[model samples]
Each structure stands twice: as structure tokens, then as C-alpha cells.
Target: MADDQSLITILEDSREIRDLLTETLQHEGFDTLSFARATEFERNMRGLKPDVCIIDLGLPDRDGLSVVNTVASNSGAAVLIISGRSNTQDKIVGLELGADDYITKPFEIAEVVARVKALLRRKAPKAEATLSKIVRFNGWTADLEQHLLTSDDGKVERLSFAEGQVLRVFLSKPNRLITRDQILDDLSNGESDNFDRTIDVRISRLRAKLHDDPNNPKVIKTIYGAGYIFIAQVG
Candidate 1:
């Protein structure tokens, strides 16, 4: 609810589905614009930038994946694909191309609304969770704005949105023990709790990107039986 009147663009060819989605989103206090073709959506995007765009693959003009790639590359809008294709491969392709979330057809309108809200929450800026645009720790610089990490030797590592968020949480409380629950709560907007494994996985991935050895890490240290401690001195 950061912006109660946040605009949402819907790009589904099915008239019935489009009407239902427009009604459901409007009921949730969102402003919506529906399009049956990708060309129309792209044309209007020049005039109006939406907070979130719901795209379907079965477009009359072009493949929706192309739209997802183009929008992600050019704009900061959150993209969600609602499609009838339920294949896991198709979903993966959509996500890999930068769609925030994917929902297969025959979905509940309530779930669609919930997913849109969740995506918006991710896009919204959390003032407290943010760090300086750039933070340096032990010869490594994390450019939070660019989502890139530069090592002392000038080796650059790219960060996914989730990775950047986890790194921000660590940098916000440098050298402090941060519980898994705290990390999960911060990232999940307090809507989830069973994230022990998820947190571990993200931490492991971050460590790998930071080149921190698991056995004797210098940056992020695991406090066995408690939580993680960012060993870096943030500046």
C-alpha cells in the first residue's frame, strides 16, 4: 500500500480473464489498464509507466517473453507472467528472462491480487533496510545502487535482487550477529517464517560470490547454533 493508486498494466488476450483481473485489481484499490496485444502495451508505455505489468504469453502480436525481456532491460517496472502454460521449463524461462513471478492459468483472482501486492512490496524501498549507495568492507566494495560487487583486485561480481537484499541486510549491521529469523522477516515482509533453509542457501550463495571460504570465512561468519555475523567493518 505504499501508493494506493499504483497503476497496473494487464496484457492478457483473453477478454474474460482480462475483465476478471481488472475487476479484482480495482477491488483491491489498484488502477489498471488492459491490453490484448503487446504492441498496444509497448506503445502506451511511452506515455504511462506502470508500477507492475501482468503479461500473458499467448499474445496476438508477439511472444510475451520478448516483452518481458524488453521491459526488464529498459524499465524498472515489476513484471509478472500469468499464462496457461504450466510446464516447469516455461516458468523457468520466464523467470530467467526477468519476470518477477509466474502464475499458471485457472488461477484464483485472490491469488493474483496477492502476488501483485507481494511484487509491489519487493519493488518498494525500505528506508531502514537500505545502506549507503556504496559500502566498502575489507577491500570489497558493494555498490547497492548498481547491484555489483567489486573486489580489491577489480574483479566484479553481479548480484541478483535477492543477493543484493541479503547483502544490504548484512551491511546494515556490520559485525553484528543477525538471526535467520531476522533476515527472513526483513525480506519476506513478515509474511513467512519457515525460511531456515532458504536463508542458509542465500548465505552460501553470497559467500561464494564474495569469495569467502565456508570453513574459515573472513567476511561473513556463521555463529553455529545461533545466526550469522558479518565480519566486515563497513564504512
Candidate 2:
């Protein structure tokens, strides 16, 4: 059962899917709002402040990926892409564009619930050792609580929940080699066969945000076959 305060917004055009998800999630103790069009979803989301947004790629009003990007950039909600496009490329693209997770058509409702639970777990505040909420590294300041990054030049960038998690992993162990498996373990993201590719795409996006050149990266150096090392001296 989800927390009473946890709200889930479902944006799917299919009435069957939309209603099914709403019924199932609501039955599981989650508050849900279903939308058939991207326009209404976008408008209501600004005020609802849901904890998770389940989006379908095929929408009548606008591209679902565009909605994913917008939500990721502007909100702290976890973005889950539920689409009929099952190709590897589509999943990769969705993750690259800021989705926290992906599910294809004909997916089991149980899996959806599990995925949502996992995302919520990751979003939940940790009660472990105390750490600073603000971290400075490589001429950048990260406000972990707000998921905002400020560059030395005064430009501020908002980080998606997924990006913020990846960044936290790197910052926690600077100048140390961190394997992809270690990253997944630290993130508490369930095991998947596409783990490598998923981590690579996330790292690539984080690098771009940090202004690190992919061709010749300085901060995060990829080890040919082992893992990656954060070279910057983090403070």
C-alpha cells in the first residue's frame, strides 16, 4: 500500500488503460487522476503536484516525450513512460529524455505497481548518516534537497530525479572507480539486462549537464571495460 499522501497522475489516451490504472492504483491506496489528453494533464499537474506521472507516448493532443521532458525539467515528480513502442531505441530515448522508468504496452498492472513503489522508495527521504544538503564540486554547487545545480558562472539548472540520484552517487565517492552495478545497487533500482546501456545513457545526460565533453571527458572518465571514475576533487 502506498502512503495516503502519495498521488499518481495517469496520462493515457486509451480509456481502458486509463481507467484500469486508476482503479488499480486507487485500490492500492494511492490517489490518482487520469487524463486522456496531454493538455489537461499538463495544466492540472502544475497544481496537483503528484509524486509520480505515468505517461503514454501516443497522445491525441501532443507528443508524450515532449510532456516527459517538460515534467522532468519543471517538476520533482518521477516520470514513468508507458508506451506501445517496445523497441530498445524507444526505451533508451525515453530514459535519455528524463524518464525514470519505462514500460511497454500489454504490461501487467502488478509490474506497474511494483515500478511505482520502487520509484517512491527512491524518492523517499533517507534516514541514514547525516550529510550536507549542499555540495560543491568542480565549480558547481548542488542543492540536493531542491535538485538544483548552480554553475560558477551563475547559471542554474534543474536536475530530474533520476539525474539527481546519479549525481549523488558520483559525488559520494569522488576520484574513485564506481561500477555500473554499484550504481544500480546504490540507487536500489531493480536488476535489468539493459543495466549497462541504461547507466551509460544516464551518465551521458549528466555529463552534458555538467558541461563535460563526451569525446574527451575530464570529470567522469570511463574505464574501457570495468567502470567509471570521478576525477574531480569534490569539496
Alpha-carbon RMSD to native, per candidate? 5.2, 2.2
- Global lDDT of model 2: 0.86
Best by TM-score: 2
Once fitted onto the true fold, the runs of candidate 1 whose alpha carbons sit more than 4 angstroms away are 130-235
lDDT of each: 0.80, 0.86
TM-score of each candidate structure, all chains considered together: 0.64, 0.88
Task: Give the clashing residue pairs of candidate 1, or none.
Answer: none
Q: For candidate 1, give the lDDT of residue 194.
A: 25
Per-residue lDDT of model 1, residues 147-207, tens digit only: 6889999998876555666788898888889987787777667643323334666677789
Candidate 2 residue runs with Cα over 4 Å from true position:
191-195
What TM-score would candidate 1 get against the native? 0.64
